[model samples]
Target: MADDFKVTDPRTLRAYAHPLRVRLIGLLRSEGPMTATRAAAALDDNVPNCSFHLRQLAKYGFAERVPGADARERPWRATARTTSWDDDSDDPAMRAATDQLNSVLLGVFTQRAQDYLATRADEPAEWRAAAGFGDMLVHVTAAELRELTEQIEALASRFDDRAADPAARPAGSRPIQLIQLAIPRGPVS
Candidate 1:
C-alpha cells in the first residue's frame, strides 16, 4: 500500500466521477498490482474497456504500470495509498464536480455495506461476532462537529500503519472497511 495521499486537479476529479473508474481504483488499492485482464475478470468487465479505463487512470496519475512485468502484460498499481480533494473549492465547476464525485463515493460505500450485510452470515463466527451497526442523533454546534470528525480521524490513524506496510499487520487479521459519515441535516422550523 502507498503511504502518501494525493490531491487531484479539477479535471481529474471529474474524471473519477465515473462509476467504473471509482470501483477500479478501490480494487487496486485493496488487492494490489493486477493486469487489466485480471481486473476485468474480477469486476466482470470487458478487458478492452478495463484497459482503456486503466490507461485513463494512468494518464491522470491515479495508477501506473508495475515494474518488470511481462512485456505484453502490463500490471498496474495505484499511485497513491489514498486520494483527497478540496471539497470546498471556491470555483463553481470544481465545487459541483466535487459534489458529484462525493455522491458517487457515497453510493459505493453504501453498496459495500449492503454487500457485507447480505453475506455476513456466511463469515466465521468470530467475524460475525465482531461486526456491528449503530447510529445516533446528536445535538452539536458546527465547530463541535468538526472537532468530532477530526478526533475520529485521529483514532482511525492509529490502525493505519498497516496501510503503508503489510508487515505491520498482526497475524489472523483480515481487511475491514470502516465507513464514517457525519451528515448535517437542516434545522426544522
Candidate 2:
C-alpha cells in the first residue's frame, strides 16, 4: 500500500467524509486487505452495504481491488496507510470538507476509546498497563509545536512497516491507535 493518500479536492474530501467509508478505510489499514463480505462481517454490517461503500471509496482512489481473485471474491485494499488533508486550507469548500471528515473521525475515535474502557477489565494485565489515555500541556510557539509534531510523527513511523507486514510485528502485538492532537487551548499570547 502507498504511504499516504493526500486528498486535495473538496469533492473527494466530501466523498470520504462518510462514517461507514471512514471505518472501512480504517479496517483495511489495520487488518490489511479483505473482501467486502469479510469486512461486512467484521463491522457487523451486510455485504451489499459494505460492497457499495467500498465501491464509493474506490471511486476516489482511496481503495482498490487486489489481483489474483475473481470479481465476487476479490479483496479490496486501502491505497494508503493513512489519509490526510489540509485542515488549514484557505478555500472555504476545502475547509468545510475537512471539518466534516474530522467530525466523523472524532466520533470514531471516541467510540473506540469507550469500547476499550468497557472491556479494559477483561484484557490481559500487560495490555491494560500498556494502554490508557495521556495528556500534556505545554507552552510553545508555532514553530516549536510544528517541530514537536514532526518529532512524534517520525517516532511513530518506526512502526509503520508493521501495519502491512504481520511477521514484522512481535508476538502479542495487535493494532493500536495512537492519536496525537496538539491544538491551541487558548488564544495565542
Candidate 3:
C-alpha cells in the first residue's frame, strides 16, 4: 500500500511547482517506479532534463530515489500525497511565485480539458458515461470548505492512479474535468 503523505510548507510548494518537477512527480505517482529514461519517455522530454528536475524534487523532500533501485536506473516517487502553501505569509516573492505556479497549472488543466472534449467524438459510450464534466456552487463555512476541497482532491487522486490498471479501460478513459467552487455569501468578520 502507498504511504499517507502531506506537505504544508511554502518551500515544499515552491519546489514542487516547477513545470518539469511537477510533471515528473505526477509521472511517478501515476506510473510507479521508473528510470529517468522511462520518465523522460513518459513526459516526452529528455533524460538529462528530467534527471535535473528529479534531483530538485528530491532536494525539496517531494521525492526520493528508491533504494535497491539501481543508480543507473534511478526511480523516484512522491513522498507526499498533497502539497499546500500558507496563504497568510507576507513574503512578496513567495506570493508571486505561488500565484504564477497556480495560474500555469490552471492553464495546463484547461488545455487538458479542451483536448479531452475535442476527442470525445472518438470515445466509446462506456467511457463517456464513466467520465463526466460539471460544476456546482455550494455554501459553506471556512472549515467546511477546506474539508470539501480535501474530499475532492482525494477523489481525483483515486482516478489518477487507476490508469495503470490492466483491465480493459473504457474508450474515453482519458482525463476528466472536475471544477469545484465555493463562494462565501458575505465578508467574514
Candidate 4:
C-alpha cells in the first residue's frame, strides 16, 4: 500500500474518526499484525465489528493485510509507521473534518492515559518508576515549540524498527506509551 502520511480528504478523515478504527490502527502499529479475531479479543468487541472497522481503515490506506496471512485468518498491519493529517487544509470541509478527527483522537488518547493510570498500580515497581506523568506549562516561541516537537519525534523514532523486528529490540526494552501535546494556553501574558 502506498503510504501517504498527510490525509487531505474529508471522507477519509471522517472514516478514521471512529473510536474503534482509531484504536485498531494504534493496536496494529504497536503490537504488530493480528487477525480480526485477535484484535476483537484484545478490544473486547465482536469479530464482525473489528473486521468491518479494519476494512474501513484499510479503505483509507491506514492498514493492510499481512502478505503471508491466509484468507481465513488475515492479519492486518499498519500501512505507515505514523499517521499525519493536515490541520490547515485549504478546503473548509476537509479542515472541519480534520478538526473533528483531532478532537476524537484527543479523546482516545485521554482514555488510553486514564486506563494506564488506573492500572498502573498493578504494574511492577520498575515500570511504575519508569512511567512519567507531568503537565507542566512551558514558555516558548512558535519556532521553539516546533523544534521541541521535532526533537520529541526524533527521540520516539528510535523504536520505529522494533515493530518490524522483535529480535532487534534490546533486552528489557518495553513498549512505553508517550504522548506529547503542545498547545498555546491562551496568549502569552
Candidate 5:
C-alpha cells in the first residue's frame, strides 16, 4: 500500500469526508484487507451500508478490490496508509473541501478521546499513565511553526511501519491515537 494518498480534487476530498468512509479506510489500512461484510461487522455497521460506502470509496480511488482465491468474496483495501490534502490550495473548491474534511476529522478525534476517557478507568495502569492529554502554547513565527510540525511528523513516521505490518508490533502493543494541532492562538496580522 502507498504511504500517502494526496487528494487534489475537491470531489474526492468531499467523498472521503464522511465519517463512516473515513473509518472504513482507516480500518482497511490498519488491519489489512477484508471484504465489505467483514469490515461492516468490525465497525459495528450493517453490510449494505458499508458495501455502498466501500464502493463509493473505491470510486474515489481511496479503496480498491483485492484479488483473492474466492471470486465471490472481494476484499477491499485502502489505496494508502494515510489520506491527506493540501490545506494551502488556491482553488476555492479545494479549500472548501479541505475545510469540510478537517471538520469531520476534528469530530472523529474528539469522539476518540471521549471514548477513551469513558473506559480509561478499566485500562491497564501503565496505559492509563502513558496516555497523554497535554498541550503547550508557544510563540513562534509561521516558518518556525511549520518547521516544528515537520519535526514532529518525522518523529511519528518512525512508527509508521508498525501500522501496516501487525507482526512488527511488539508484545503489549495497542493502538494509540496521537492528535496534533498547531492553531494560532491569536488573530493573524
Candidate 6:
C-alpha cells in the first residue's frame, strides 16, 4: 500500500484547485491508474491537453506516474487520500477557482446521472425499483459532522481501492453516485 499524502499547504491547494486538474485527479482517484489517451477519451479532451494537466497534477504532488509503466504512455494515480482547501483567510483567486471547480464537478456528474436515468427509464421494473436518487437535510453537532465525514470517507476509500481491480468486480456493478455534503444549518450564531 502506498503512503497517503497530505495537502495542507496553500500553494498545493491552489495547484490542485484548477477545474481540469481537479477533475483529472478525481478520475484517477476513482478509476485508478490510467494513461493520458484513456483519460482524454473518458473526459472528451485532447490527449495533449489531458497530458498537460496530468503533468501539472504530478508537479503539485497530487498524482504520480505508476512505476514500470511505459514512459511514452504514462499512467497516473492520486498520491493522497484527500486534497482539501482551507479558507481561513479570504483569497479571491483561490476562492474563485474552488467555486468554479465545484460547479464543474457538479455539472459533469449531474449530466452523467441524467443520462443514466434516461437510459434506464424503460428497463425492467426490478431495475427501476433498485435505482435511487435522493437527498436529505440533517442537523448535527460540529464534532458529530466531522465524525460522519470521516466515516463516509473511509467507506469511499474502500471502494476507491477496489476500483483498481478489473477482475474482482461484477459486470452489473456500475459506478454509483455518492455526494457527501455537510453544510451549516443556517448563518452562524
* RMSD (Cα, Å) of model 4: 2.0
* Residue pairs in collision within model 6: none
Taken over the whole model, the C-alpha lDDT of each candidate is 0.85, 0.91, 0.70, 0.86, 0.89, 0.74
Give candidate 6 misplaced runs (Cα > 4 Å): 1-3, 81-111, 114-127, 151-161, 166-171
Off by over 4 Å in 2: none
Clash count per candidate: 0, 0, 0, 0, 0, 0
For all predicted structures, in order, the TM-scores are: 0.89, 0.95, 0.71, 0.89, 0.95, 0.72
| Leading candidate by lDDT | 2
Q: Runs in model 3 with CA error above 4 Å?
A: 1-5, 88-94, 150-189
lDDT of 2 by residue, 30-132 (tens): 8888999899999999999999999999999999999787866789999998898887889999989998988888888888899899999999999999999
How far is 97's C-alpha from truth in model 4 (Å)?
1.4
Per-model root-mean-square deviation over C-alphas: 2.1, 1.2, 4.3, 2.0, 1.3, 3.6
Sequence-dependent TM-score of model 3: 0.71
Which consecutive 10 residues in model 3 have the weakest lDDT in total?
Answer: 1-10
The lDDT of model 4 is 0.86
The 10-residue segment of model 1 with minimum total lDDT is: 1-10
In model 3, which residue pairs have backbone atoms overlapping below 3 Å?
none
Candidate 5, poorest ten consecutive residues by summed lDDT: 65-74
